[model samples]
Target: MLTIGTKAPLFAAESTKGRIDLQTLIGKKKLVLIFYPGDETPICTKQLCAIRDRYSDLEAADAVVIGINPADLTSHQAFSGKFGYDFPLIADEDQAIRKAYKVGKILGFLFQQRIVYVIDKQGTIVYAKKGNPPVTELLQVVNQNP
Candidate 1:
């Protein structure tokens, strides 16, 4: 996984909200990249929904929450539509972004491990951890950084 204090890898990919370019967002907004195993799975849904529940707080902090997985755009769209998620879910079907971030696979390469990264406006990753961390903790980091 990517470590804290490292420059975030840049990429452009299709998302539910249209094409997303990391370079364009780098200097403009803080970023929360939630890398999950699969779309609509129990743990993944719960993890993202927690962010959805408190999305306004993230927005108020000038942060954009993006979900990334190997799922295709169609799967991401269906999941986002069902959950009413406001943020973009990147269709990393090729797993290029995953590879760039050094996210590893589990279940014998069937699923990517769940990880969360908080990147500051300058595109430096400030927080990197595994599993589902509380949104409050994430807010503290984002609010504390800038």
Candidate 2:
């Protein structure tokens, strides 16, 4: 996992909202980057759904929440539509973003490890954790860093 206070690796990838370059949002918004295993899976869905439930709070804190996985755009679209998630879901089809972040695999490479990173407005990571963390905890980190 990327450590706290490290500069986030920048990347441009196709998302549900089209192409997004992390560098562009560096000074504009704090980032909540959720790296999950797959789309519409049990735990992944629950994790993203939690974020969706509190998305307004995240927005109010001046954050841009993005979910990433190796799932393609079509899979992402269907998942997002089914869940009514307003945030962009990146289709890391080639796993380039995952590799850049050093997110490892689990269960003999069957799935990517779930990780979450909170990047402040200046593009430095403020929080990095494994598994599903509560949204309140994320909000707390964002509020503290800001």
The TM-score leader among the candidates is: 1
- Candidate 2 regions exceeding 4 Å error are none
Taking the tens digit of each residue's C-alpha lDDT, what string does model 2 give over 22-123? 989999999999999999899999999999999999999999999999988999999999999999999988898999899999989988899999999999
lDDT of 1 by residue, 11-96 (tens): 99999999999999999999999999999899999988999999999999999999999999999999999999999999998899
For residue 53, what is the lDDT in candidate 1? 97
Which lDDT value does model 2 have at 132? 97
Collision count for each candidate, in order? 0, 0
What's the true lDDT of residue 43 in model 1? 95
Regions of candidate 1 where Cα sits further than 4 Å from its true position:
none
RMSD of 2: 0.7
